[model samples]
Target: MSPVLQIALALGSVVGLMGFMAGVRHLAGTWQIGSEVQRKLVHIGTGIYALTLPWLFPDRWPVYLLVGLTLIVMLLLRLPNSRLGATLHSVERQSYGDFLLAISVGVCLFLAGDQLYLYVLPIAVLTLADAAAALAGSTYGTKFFRVEEGEKSLEGSAVFFTVTLLISVICLMLMTSFAPPNIIVLSLMVAGFGTLVEAASWRGFDNLFLPVGLLIFLSAHGTSTLGELVFLAAIFALSIVAFKIVAPKFGLNAHAVRVYVTSIFLLLAVTDPQNTIFPILVLVAHIWRRSVAPCDSKFPDLDVVAALVLVSLGFLTLGKATGPTAISFYGIAAMGMLMGFCAIAASASRPVVRYPMVLALALALFAIREGVVRLNPDSANWNGPMWPAVFICVALTALGPMILSRVFATHRVVKLTFLALLIPLPYYVISTGF
Candidate 1:
């Protein structure tokens, strides 16, 4: 077959499937089906199609071509003149969730190479788990917590975690050579991360946060013994049960307790048992100080727990990264904490980074102190190359965004998140002299 013809044929098939979904959406709406119900159908159908990407295209270029084209089309569909624009675009205003969703698939394709599981894991979870969470929540949701304008329920989150857990396990087992125990831990960790990212995400930004994050962090860390794996799984299960048992007392957001336990389990998986205290201690303080039920207020402080998850991830990353690479982890971790502050500050409709800069500086200082204590406590190597640069970069990156956020004035969380991810690239480049 001619290469051009094959490419044309492949692209047509993708567009055709999308057209079919659009037709279904329209027909369903005309038949008096709810818009939200039709939306979920499109969501699941699109997701099921996404799973076929690794198999549908023989190479990465085709994946890129299809995804890029889809993204452009989706963007155009949001314009005022488009036929279905009114139905497709949310009535509220401009929503970038669909845009981010396509971009995430492109990113997973670009970076995944032969690691199909890595690409598939995030997409599948977002598709199935997220859809399930939404469907179950909307239908059965009773106890409420706030996200943009809607309230997410405990029941829906449980559905998300269950589905995500199943998907993660299947992805790991099918794609990797890992044993049962490692698969269990890895799946639990990935599911936990997805839940938090999904919970914290607003305006469909979870698409970006969940997949991009898993792409970076969700590798199968091997477990040495079945006994150790069993013990690890036991702790994870107990933590969930404990939270469910106790969360009612505080009207806690399930996302918080869910992510906190995941952090501890992941930290235990990656880091030495000794260094676990810093992250755990921080979690304890967060929980201990919450005297009121999280749901007492019309709005809950979602950022604090979500930000800690990112920081905990940074700490865990350090255990895996080495030498020059390890040095980059500090800056990444600092930004993780800073990103948290930005999330919180954005919720209050404030110019967050202006004040988040203080948190950034404090975290930088803590990083420095931890570095001093951990690396060279015997000697006063206060003049190290990495810590100094990390401090400067952390401050500059955290505050620099304040100006940009002020100017942009909307979607600061999304903007700050990408900025935070970018801040570490230079450190990696400089470290490798790339």
Candidate 2:
């Protein structure tokens, strides 16, 4: 089909899907159905429709156009006067799920070009598994646990895992060339991590994290043997167990620990295991600060995890684009140093004390990173930052807490600007050796 015709059909199909969702919402409202049910209905419908993208557009521009228009519509739905908001916004918790859903579709489609299974599998889980978890939780959930935003039930998480495992198996069998052993290992891996991510995520972020994380994991480890995959899984499990044991000693909340652990495992799956050490140290420092002087802040832990993940993914992308250099790892380590500074800055009331402590921590972490590199020279080789470069990165990261305290000090939802500001520093430092 011609590009113009393809774009036309895509837009029409999206409009039709919206009309169907609106009709469903109207009927549900007439019947006094719960808002959550109405939202999930729309969610499922959107995901199912998204699955048809490979067939609809021969090029990605059509998908981008569709995503942009749909995102505008979703944002419009958030307006107080808009009737559509009633269905999607009925939940009490704060959420940007609708926005994330639209963005994930476009991004995932782009990443999976000419690879239908890569695209379909993640979307299917996003659709079927997520809806199943929500419904199962509401209907059958009994045991509840606290998270950053709200409480999730064990029953729901279990349902999510089961469904995700099934989806993984089915998608792999039909879509890939993996053997039975590989399929089993891969399905288990996705299911375990997906459940953790969903349980830990708040504010509709699972919509974004689920598909993107899946794509990264599949792309990175798709060709590994069963033993290799199992070894990776074992490392993830052991790390989680270790964190769970130590987190309480540091006075970190269960929710915060889960976010930290899940993000680390996601990193481990997507990149080298050693690459996880930097973020792990940054988190430990944050928790240690919390342990020393606990502050009562309502800012969600998931937001912190989201910020870290976003920054790391940026460096990781740069690594791929630049090709075959350990520049990405260096960039991430630099980010880790910046975050380490921010984490300490959050606790240190005096600049004199904070700066020294941050400097020491950064040097120590860098030393450790060097030791690891020396042990596994083939894994990565990159020069350590000079004293001036270290100071510059620290100086840049110091602005994070200051700006955050001035602008968002009182807000309930923490802005991502602190870490987002640190993004360019790593790239600039590593790319130019400045």
Candidate 3:
């Protein structure tokens, strides 16, 4: 059979299972197993079905096919009169979790090559671990923390971290023959990051970020040093403590701490902390974005100098830098900080500002490109070949949220900006060094 046909058949079976789930819901006497559980049932199926795609097709064509089909089905299901649409319409109604699941699959396939460990790890954890977290938190969760997109349960997040740790350790150990001494630490780091991404995910955004985040961490496996692990651990610990003492309103609860920690860990895992500007900027941007309100301060209340000092100290103790590296670091940090301020400023702005904001982003990218070329002429690694790709990515990172903001009013431009930054900027930065 053709690979595409084989994939179609396999997907048909999965849909049949969904139909069975629909039957189970009906026979259980509710005709609806409730919207959230309905979502979970689908989420659980995706975990299983995702495992089959990479194994069955062994190429990206089927993976993209799956993404396209899922997106089409998801949109069709949203039609007001369709039965399946009515069924799923209220399942995390505002978000595109299923669509992101397919995107994650496509991304992993593209980046992972033949590394089944990398491809399967994210899909399995995202599918099963996330489903487990949701079920545990929703059923038994009592303690809640305010997350940017939604409220998360401590119990649920713990469940997510534990499951992700187990999956990463067992799977990666099998893949690389357990070479790294800090495998346990790596597991903890992945789990912590998984929890962090989950906590930050709003309106089903976890579906998109979680797999992508997992792929980034997995790429660094067996290549990270013991000291790097420790440095990442300390960064998270101190940052969470500082956030608690200094900006508790930044959502420095246990769940939020895990998110912040995971981010720093990913950066350390993927690239040098000395050029740590981008990661710090991304983390701070999210915190700053969350800490603001439309009726509140016009200027940010954040202590920028303190954040600068903490990351700078961490980098200095563990990293080596040259003049060019310093310039690149500060340049990226300045652009990111400005983006964050733009997000904060957007909270109260009128609808007419998006075009000018996009135009400003274009001009900023142009100037940043010229400045980077002048100051970092010796930065040939990225500047030589990947410069245009990097420039496009940075521009997309800055402009994406402003464009998306017109569509999603429930989330501020800043909230959208968090995903925008988290997704693309890290990729550009990591590609430069790793």
Count of backbone clashes, every candidate in sequence? 0, 0, 1
TM, every model: 0.63, 0.84, 0.67
Regarding lDDT, does 2 or 3 come out ahead?
A: 2
Count: clashes, candidate 1: 0
> Over the stretch 1-434, how does candidate 2's per-residue lDDT look in tens digits?
79879789778976886797789788996998898999999999889989988876777788888998888878777887877677889899988899999888877787676677778989999999999999999999999998765898999999999999999999999999899999999999999988888887888988988888888778778789988999989988898789889878766677777788878767766656666666666565555544553444665355456766766665554454455354434444445444543544454567667656656655665576565555544534444434445444545455555445554343312342344334444655565453
Tens-place lDDT per residue, model 1, 78-106, is 77777554445643533566777777787
lDDT score of residue 158 within candidate 3: 91
Among the numbered candidates, top TM-score falls to 2
Provide the lowest-lDDT 10-residue window in model 2: 408-417
lDDT of 3 by residue, 265-305 (tens): 55565555444444465456546555543323221222232
lDDT value, candidate 3, whole model: 0.61
**Residue pairs clashing, model 2:** none
